[model samples]
Target: MKHRTPRGFKRIPAWMFHSRLPVDAETRLITSYLLTSGSANHPTVSELSDALCMDAKTVRRNVYKLEELGLLKVIRRAK
Candidate 1:
């Protein structure tokens, strides 16, 4: 399946690659991954962990980071 890159992000800034904090880098990577996931997949934390080759903790942390930055919204569903 082909995915479309989101508008306004046609080019990722080079500075994202040189961020000083490790979390900043991971957050940017997660953002990139999420942008690539496109408008279809709403992956769970475990799934994101698997795709990104990171642990669940790392995935969750970066997800929250993205949320804080207003780049992504995390919806909680009641079980």
Candidate 2:
């Protein structure tokens, strides 16, 4: 299991800070959080909202944007 804490040191790619992608600040923030914070494929939206201090709806929207760019895949867990 990934050893995650409420806050901890995370390795982030330098490219993220200097990428040429036409992503907004929020998209970049979401990408950074996922790269450093989320599970391999299970970054919770609630966790993202709490950490980033943004609304869940906003989080979902940015996530969708990231998905559309083909940066990551969203695998919904079975209910």
**Which candidate has the top score in TM-score?**
2
Each candidate structure's TM-score, on Cα atoms with residue i matched to residue i, is: 0.59, 0.61
Count of clashes, each model: 0, 0
Best by lDDT: 2
lDDT tens digits, residues 30-67, model 2? 76667665454566889889988999999999888777
After superposing candidate 2, which stretches have Cα over 4 Å from the reference? 1-22, 38-40, 73-79
After superposition, which runs of candidate 1 have C-alpha atoms over 4 Å from their true positions?
1-23, 73-79
Give the C-alpha lDDT of model 2: 0.65
